[model samples]
Target: MKDILMEIIESKRITLREQKKAVPAQLLENGASEERKMFSMRRALANSSTGIIAEFKRKSPSKGWINRDASPEEVTAAYQANGASALSILTDTPYFGGDLKDLRIARPEVNIPILRKDFIIDEYQLYQAKIIGADAVLLIAAALEKDECLQLAEKAHELGLEVLLEIHSEKELEYVDSAIDMVGVNNRNLGTFVTDVENSFRLASMLPKDMLLVSESGISSPETVKNLRQAGFRGFLIGENFMKTSNPGEALGSFIKQLN
Candidate 1:
């Protein structure tokens, strides 16, 4: 059987081929040059009370069709106004029901850093992220080799974009390079699609002490957030918890309040 992560990455390659033809690499480079001033997600998470990177995801392969009609502008504005330390906007269309338009729409509405949540396989996507007004990009360890991850991280930093390296297990830790600004432990197993928050706790002690730690997925409660924080996690990326609700921003606000 084929793995879901590999499947998404292969699909991403096909999509990127078409996108590059529609908008050449040079054009993307030009657009990146004109992007607004960059924000530091690392800095925001370090100083934030909630340390929440509120995510705006329409859907996922595991959970389908989550708020397909949610407006990025409305949701992101609410997230920022409510106390989101940063923003995460899914830009993958095939499996995640997101597009670059979502990030573009959300960019002007919020002042916080916005992470381009996608399966980054090549350097072209890094330029695409910069051109699309993303302050950061997610590089999944399971999707790329160690050298590829390091190269992508270097390229992202050169373009003034931060790299949030996502890892699922301890072996993936080798993918962490000096260029990575944040290390996120995704609790959901990409192969089985099962999530356990304990994955964060299990891996917390193994992560580099100097690197900022972020706990992603399977985090739904303020108590969970508080516990993760106590375990040395500075960032929490929550999506389905808030997006599943009728009012995601308000949901996020309530969650943050509970944390305080």
Candidate 2:
């Protein structure tokens, strides 16, 4: 079977090289350093009745072009007004059909915490996230080594961005650390592109009980969110479920209604 994760990372490196030339690291850092207050995704989930981190995505490697014409500003604002605890913006262009402009545009549209969801493997991306006004970043355990993850997480902290460490299996659990503001269990296997919401249930017990647990991907119904909440999950990172619909915010609003 082809490894989709490896392919994305390779493409990401090539994209980064071009981006780095366009915007030097020091210039990116300077922009990120400008005074900006960050909303806490962890706290938002903790305090919300529906811990829905609504995502705005155009496409995916598993299911291409989910919503090619969705406007980041319109969808994200609707998400905030309709009852989302936070927002997640996909920033990977090659596979996800998104770029930094998605987050940059969506950032000012919503007051809720916005998580920059991408195949992040470099520290330079952290600055990119911060400069674009993202409050959090997704760090996939399968995409990075322990040392690399730690270094990137530390850099994220220095830039005042929270880190959501994503793990797919028991082995990847080792990447959990103090730097992580939230621990997310990815339901889809990056290597195979297969998804099962039960993956969250299977790993829920083994994850740190005190950590803010988040269930990511393959979550279509509110019933699953309720079950995961009972299993100690505080947040649910849902994208395709809502993005695939004609109106993502309305889809998210209807999903939240079921949760209540």
Best by TM-score: 2
Worst 10 residues of 1 by lDDT: 27-36
- lDDT of every model, 2 decimals: 0.92, 0.92
Error of 1 at 212 (Å): 0.4
**Candidate 1: stretches off by over 4 Å:** none
- The alpha-carbon lDDT assigned to residue 82 of candidate 2 equals 84
Clashing pairs in 1: none
What is the C-alpha lDDT profile of model 2 across 1-260, one tens digit per residue? 99999999999999999999998999987888898878999999999888999999899887888999999999999999889999999998889999899999988788899999999988899999998999999999999999999999999999999999999999998899888899999999999999999999999999878899999998988999999999999999998899888898899889998899
lDDT of each residue in 25-108, candidate 1, tens digit only: 888787777747899999999998889999999999988999999999999999999889999999999999999999988898
The Cα error of candidate 2 at residue 119, in Å, is 1.0
What are the TM-scores, per candidate, against the unseen true structure? 0.98, 0.98
Residue-level error in angstroms, candidate 1, position 74 = 0.5
